[model samples]
Target: MLPVDAMITNQEKLNSLATECAFHRFSIAEIQAATRNFHNDLVIGKGGFGKVYKGRINGTRDTTRRIVAIKRLDSFSMQGAAEFMTEIEMLTKVRHSNLVSLIGYYFDDNEMILVYEYITNGTIEHHLRKADAPLSWMHRLKISIGAAEGLNYLHTGVGNQQGVVHRDVKSSNILLDENWVAKIADFGLSKFIDQQTSGVSTRLKGTFGYLDPEYYMTGRLTRKSDVYSFGVVLFELLTGRRAVDTSFREEEWNLAKWAEKCVKERRLDQIIDSHIKAQISPKCLKEFVQIATRCLKSCRKKRPTMAGVVLALQQSMALQEQYDSSPQSASFTHIVQHLFSGSRLNSVVSTSASAPVTPIPHRFSSPPVTPSPHRFSMSPKLDKIDPVHLTLNLVARATQNFSPSLKLGEGGFGTVYKAELPEGQLFAVKRAKKEHFEALRSEFRSEVKLLAKIDHRNLMKLLGSIDNGNEHLIITEYVPNGTLRGHLDGAHGSVLDFCQRLEICIDIAHGLTYLHIYAEKKIIHGDIKSSNILLTERFRAKVSDFGFARLGDAETDGAQVVNKVRGTLGYLDPEYMRTHQLTPKIDVYSFGVLLIEILTGRRPIQSKRSPDEKVTLRWAFGKYIEGDIMDLVDPQMKESLDIEIIEKIFELAFQCAAPTRADRPDMKVVGEQLWAIRMDYIRNGRRG
Candidate 1:
C-alpha cells in the first residue's frame, strides 16, 4: 500500500539510528587485525580497568605506519557506557604540552578500545623505583618544575572552558615525553569547576600519601589540595625514600614524619639519596627540603601558592649564578695588597681634581673600562704635574690630619677608619697604602662604580668616595651591630630566635633575587657566606663586599672560571675547587653551609669528635639519617625548640648542601620554603 519513494526514506532513517545506538559498530575483524590478532607480545601494561597494548596502525591504501597505545577496556567493567561518554567528552576538550593526548576510541558490544599517544619514557613512578636507573638532581629539579607548571596550568590556565582539578596528582599519573619533559596523564578522575564556584565538594579520593589531609577530613577540594600532594612528590625527590615504607615501625613509617624528625635533629644528610650526595650544592638541597616540608604540612591553608612555588625555583637558580661568578678570596687579597702598596696620599690628593671619573657599570653586568694613562697626558694643562706631590697631600687629609684615633681596622690593603662628617653622619673610610697606587686606583674605581649602582636594604650602602690627591678613600655605611660572624661569636643571650633567624634568611634571599633577576642586568654575589652577610640592630641580614665580584659573560669572563680558589674555606664549593669552574651553585653551597650552622648551632667544621664520628655538619647529617638525630641537635637549644620546625629547617639545610650544583635549588625557592615553614609554625603554635 506504501509508495516506493516513502519506503526508501523510512529505511534510510532506520539505518542512521542504528549507527548511533549500536555498541559494536566497529567490526571485530578490523580491531583484531589492527592489534595483530590480539597477540600476547603486543601487551605493554595492565591495570584494573583494562590492558594497554602497543600497536602499529596501517593506512587503508599505502600501509603507512603510526604507533599508538591501545587500551582495551574489560567487557565486564562497572564503568559502562556512561563513564565512557564522560571520559570521551572531557579528554576531547582538553589539550596542553604537559598532558597526554587521546587519539581515537572504539566501542564494540563486548569490549571498548582507547588509543593514546605513545609516551616513550613511561611513568614517573618507574624512574623512582628503578635500582639500576640513575636520576640526577638536576633532572629531578627539572621534573619537579615541569610537573608543577603542568598542574598549575590545569588548575588556573586560561581557555575556552573552566579550569580542571586533577584530583589524582601523583607520581604515577605523571608521564615523561621522549625528551624527559613531564606530561600529566589520566584525567578520568579529574573534575571541572565552573568559574563561579570557589571549590568543589566530593567523596574523598586520591592515593594514600598524596591525599590532602584537609580534603580527607572535609571532602572539600581546592588548588591547595594539589599543593599538598606535590609536597609528597617533593619528599620522594629529596630523600629517595618511598612515601609509605612499611619496613620501618609505625612511628617511623610515614616519610613526611620521618623527614620532619630528621630535619629537626639537623640530620637531613642521613635521608638524602647517596648517589647524588656529592653532586648537589648545599644551598639547593636545603631549599628543596624546606619546600617539601611546606608541601607536607598537616594544614593545607599554610601551603604556598603555586605562583609562589615557581618564583621560589627561579630564586634558587639565581643563587647558583652568584656562586659561579665570584672570584677567589686570594685574588681579592692580592688586589687589596696592591692597592695599599702602590698609591701614596700626596699623589692621590694632587690627582683628585684632575682624575677622570667614569661611572662604573651596574652589578651583574660588565664594568666599563677606564681611559688609558696616555689620554690624560694628551691634555696640555695636566701634562706637566708631578705625581709624587699629589699623593702626599691626599694621604695627609685622609688621616684626619694624621690623628691616630681615626684608625678603624687594619687589613691587607691598609687601615680603615671611622670618619665623622660635618653633618655628624658616621662613615668607614679605607685608606690605600702608597706602594700599591695602580691597584688602589683600580680597586677604588671598581668599588665606587659597583657600589654606587647597587641599592639593597640588606647590602651596605656606599655613601661616597673621597679622592683628596694624596690618598684614595672609599666610604661606606657603618653598621653599629657589626659583622654576622662577630655577633654569632660574642652575643651573650640567645643570639637569634627561630623567627629572627628565619627573617635573616628571607632578607638575604630577597636581596640576592634582586641582584640576580630584578636588577637591570643579572648580578651574582660571588662570595655569599655568613661572614659577608652583616646584621643590623634588628638582626636583619645585609650582604656586603663586591671586591671579588665579576660580571658574567662567556666571552668577556672567559668561560666561568676562577683563577684561584676563592671564598671561605669551610663554605667553598667542592666542584669549583676541583674544576676551577665557578657557577651560581657555589653561592648555594656556601649558603647551605651557613644554613646548617644556623639550624644545628654548629660550625661548618669541627675538630672535637669521636674516632668513628664525622666532625663536619655534612657527616653529622648523614648520621642523623641513620636514626641518630638526637646526637646532632645542639645540646643548649634542643629542649626549647619545636621538634617539627627544627626538623624542617634541618631538611632545608641538607638540600642546600647537596654536592651537585644542579641539585641545589635557587635562593628564591629557599626563601619561600623558609617562609612557609615559619607560617606553619605560627599557625600551629610551634609543635614540640
Candidate 2:
C-alpha cells in the first residue's frame, strides 16, 4: 500500500487528469457485465497491471456495440492509481493513428478499469514468440515505421505541452490492428518532460532487458532513454528473439549488448533472423542496422530522437521497395549513388538521425559563379510573403567590401553594415566575426531558425542570409533612422517627445505580446535592452537581434534552470543572474528598465552621475516610491507632462520590475495597462 502522503499526491494528480479527460465513466455493474464478472476465459492479456479482458460494449455516441479491451486492476497488482490516471491523461490529450485510443474508464468501488478501442491483432511480442506464423521483412519494416511514428509524437509532444517519455517502451507495448497498422499502447510508466529540463530524475521503472543502461544506473530519465529502449525493440523485430533469455550465457543474455558486439565485429549476417534473411535487401539492412546501433549507444545524448528513428525506418522501407521493383542484377551502390546525387537525399543525409534536426537554410552562390534568383520561402507563418535570396558578391558590392564608412553599429555576435543594392533598395547586413567561429556559427543558425518562423510588423524582418566558406551574413530590411538608443542619446539630431516615446513603448509591447503568446511557440527574448530596439524613419520601434532568444518555459512552475546566463549587464534581471532560473518575466524586467530609460532619456547605468543617481532604474524607483515621479521625466522634453499619467506609468514600471517573477505581470496585462495609460494621456490633451 502507498503511504498516506503518496496516496494524497496520487489523488491530486488523478483529479487534475480528470479535468482534461472527458471520457465516459462506467459504473461497477457496467464494468463487471462487460468483463463477464472477471471470468478467466475472457482474459486476453496479463501484466503487472493485471488482466485485460476482451469485451463488447456500446460505442461512444452510437447505438451499435463494438469490441473493447477492458483493463481491470487486480487487488495485488504492482501498478496502482498513478499508472491508471497517467494513461487516461495521456490518451485523452493525444490522438494519432499510430497510437491506441482510450474509450472510457471506471473507478467505482475500488475496482479500477480502463476501456480501450479493441485492436484485432495482439501485441508484437505475441506474434514474434507465440504465433506459428513468421513476420516477413516488409511487414516488419512497416511495423517499425508505424511504431517509430507513434513514439516520435509522444516525444515531440501534443500542441504546446511538454513531451511525454514512455519509460517502458518495448515489444509488448506495440499492438497491431486488422490492416497490420501498428498502435503503441500501455502508458503505465510514462512521464511528462519539463519543457526546459534536459532530463528528469526519478525512481527506476521499466522492464529489465529493455531499460536504458544510463537511466538504470544513474536514474536520470530523458526522451533519449526511451530511444534506447526502442532500439532494443528494433533488435527484437530484426532477430526474432526475446530481449532477455537467462538460459543463454551471461554476456549473450542481453540482446542489445550482444547485437552491438555483432555489429562491431562485422558479423551482422550471423544474427539476422533466418525467416527474413533471404527477403532483406543489403542496402535496407545497412540503413536499419545503422539506426538501430545508434539508438543503443551508451551515451544518452548520442541516441537519435524518435523523429529521426522514424525517418531512418522510412528510408529503409523505401530502399527495400526500390530494390523489389528493380531487377536482381541492379547494383545497390548505383541506386544509392543516384539517390544521393539528388537534392532530397543530400538534404536528408545532412540532417542525420544521430544529430539534432534543424531546418536547412537556403544556400546561395558565392564567388566565381553566376548568381541566380533563389526564392527564400519560409513555412506556416511566413507563407504570405515572397522573399528573394541575395548573393554574397552582390552584398559585398553594395556594402563597399564591408567598408567602415558604411558600418552602422556592432551587435552581440557581429557587425552591422548598411547597404544599398543596385536596384536602390536599402538593407542591413550583419557579418559575424571569424574569431570564436563555432559559437558565432551556432548563434547564426539559432537566429536564422527563429527569424524564419516569425513574421510580424514590429519584429525585424529577415530578408536573406549568406554562409560562404569563412563569411556568415544575415541581411534584414534596413531601418534608416538608426536605433532607439541613438535617438535617445540625440545622435538622431533631436530627442523624441513624450507622445512618440509612448507609441514606441506600445509597439515594443505589441511585439513582445506576439512572441510570448500569439506565436506558434512561445519565445523569450533573453536580452531586451533599449540598444537592441530599432526605429524606422517615422520612429516606429521594431525589436531585433534574436541571438539570445529561446523557447519559453512550458513547465507549470513558470521557470527553467539554465547552465549559462546571457544578457546585457545593466538591464539583466537580478533574480535570473542570482538563481540561473529563466522565465519570461526576465524580459519584463528589462522592459521596465527600458521604460525608465525612455522617460528619463538616460542609459541604464551612468558611472559619471552622482552615487545616488548612478543606476537609472534604482534611482528612478526610489524617487517614484517617494512621490517624486515627476522628477524622473526627461528634462529635455519641452512639453508640460501630465502628473496623473506620469504617476501611473511609474507605478506600472515598478510592478514590471518586481524583485521576483511571480509578482510581475505577464506581457498581456502589461500591454493592456500601457494602452490605458496612453488613452488617459490623450483624453487630457497632454500629447506633446
Residue 680 lDDT, candidate 2, scale 0-100: 70
The C-alpha TM-scores of every prediction are: 0.55, 0.51
Candidate 2, residues 565-668, lDDT tens digits: the string is 77775666766765677788889988988888898988876767886676776677545533355788988888888775776676667667655565467888
Q: Write the per-residue lDDT of candidate 1 for residues 422-524, one digit (tens) a residue.
A: 4454546565665665655654566566676777787767655545444465666656565555545545344665666677877877777666556555555
Error of 1 at 532 (Å): 1.2
Residue 5 displacement in candidate 1 (angstroms): 39
For model 1, what is the error of residue 18's alpha carbon versus the real structure, in angstroms, after optimal superposition?
29
Candidate with top TM-score is 1
lDDT of 2: 0.77
Query: Would you give me the overall lDDT of model 1?
Result: 0.61
Ten contiguous residues with the weakest lDDT in model 2: 345-354
Best by lDDT: 2
